[model samples]
Target: MQSTLERASHWLALLCKIVAGIALLALLGVTIADVSTRYLYRLTEGAIALRVIGSVELVSYLMLLSLLAAMAANVEKSQVVVEAFSHGLSPNLKNRLHGVYLLGFAALGLVLFIGLLDSATAAARHGEVTQDLRLPMGPIYYMAAVLSLLLGLRSLIHALLSAVFGAEGEVSHGE
Candidate 1:
């Protein structure tokens, strides 16, 4: 059962990374397009209005959202953590520390998720909209909430499994 759960977590983590990679590429493409369009064009009044009112606003906001997704995925994988202590600890201790670290991370993710949801709700109440396109801000907030929940879940599963099985079993760290 522990092995199965660990395998499932690994698969889920892999899926998250793949999704993050795709989002990062989309963000890069949007950024390049935005920059290229700005540098190559001298638009008339109407065209300028359209650019300001359409693609620019959408692309910019979506790129930011996508980047956040990628960042959250990295955090979920513990890739963002410094590894200076790994070499000094026994594998079992290292694994237990990892579990504690993940639990802390999961708590943080939950806090952020709640904060974002509150902010989004407030924005929605105030009818907040994007500057140029006037797109609703609530959806972006909800997206952030979704990403945060995913990270929280990832951390939680790892932490719980590590705590319960640390004595008899452990997740492989390539050690």
Candidate 2:
């Protein structure tokens, strides 16, 4: 079961990274189109009033999605750790410290996931939407919440294993 879960978790992280990559590419394309259109319109003295409505809103949401989607992969790779004060620890001690750190990260991710869920629910209740495109916000929030939950669960499991086995069964992924 643990092996199965490990495989599942690895696949999940890979999926998240793929989603994040797509989101980043979409964001780049949207930004370039928006800017090019705006510049053309300005250059033509309003002759070409080419404007992508809600481009800003779309970009913001995409940015958030990109971050959220990449989060699980980062957790799996131990890429989110700070490096300001841990230059002196031995490998074993560092492993233990990472376990503790992952536990704290899991708690933080759970809190953020709950907040995202609550905000999604509230948005759904209020029928909230983007100003120009009228795109619904609830679904985006829910997506973020799901990603956060995935990351939190992965972190919790990795932390538990590392705490118990001193990084032998860890999900640090060679970190």
Candidate 3:
């Protein structure tokens, strides 16, 4: 049962990484277009006004999503370690310590997951929309909430593996 959950989490983290990568690419494209448009407008002296409303706002929101989406994969792979005091500890001890840290992350993630859900609900209730595009911010907020939940779940799974099964190899931990 535990292994199944771990496998599922690994797949989810991979999915998140792919999605985040795509979003990052989109962000890059959007940024280029935005800069080019502004530059062209300046060059043409308002003759070629390629102004995109809400472009800045769109990028801001998309960046947030990209970060959120990538967070789970990073956490799952133990790439965000602090390594503050693991120099002298044995491998077993280090792994256990890492596991404890992961549990803390899991707890924090759970809190954030719930908080985002509430925020999403509030945004929906208020019908929050972007200033220029008039795009409802609620759906993205909810999407972020979902991503947060996935990150939290991944953390919890890592914590459990560290605590119960001890530190396994990269393949076992879904490197």
Residue 12's lDDT within candidate 3 is 84
Q: List the residue pairs that clash in candidate 2.
A: none
RMSD of each: 4.5, 3.0, 2.3
Clashing pairs in 1: none
Candidate 3 segments exceeding 4 Å error: 78-84, 169-175
How displaced is residue 37 in candidate 1, in Å? 2.0
Best by TM-score: 3
By lDDT, the candidates rank as 2, 3, 1
Backbone clashes per model, in order?
0, 0, 0
TM-score of each: 0.72, 0.84, 0.88
The C-alpha lDDT values of all candidates are 0.67, 0.79, 0.78
Q: Against the true structure, whose lDDT is highest? A: 2
Worst 10 residues of 2 by lDDT: 166-175
- The better-scoring model by lDDT among 1 and 2 is 2
The 10-residue segment of model 3 with minimum total lDDT is 166-175
Tens digits of per-residue lDDT for model 1, 1-90? 777766766665666667667766766776677766665555553365323236566666666566555645554346343578577767
Tens-digit per-residue lDDT, 1-175, candidate 3: 6678678877888888987998899889889999999999999999999876778888988898899889877775664555676677777776666677788778877888888889888889999888889898788888888888878888877777776667542326534
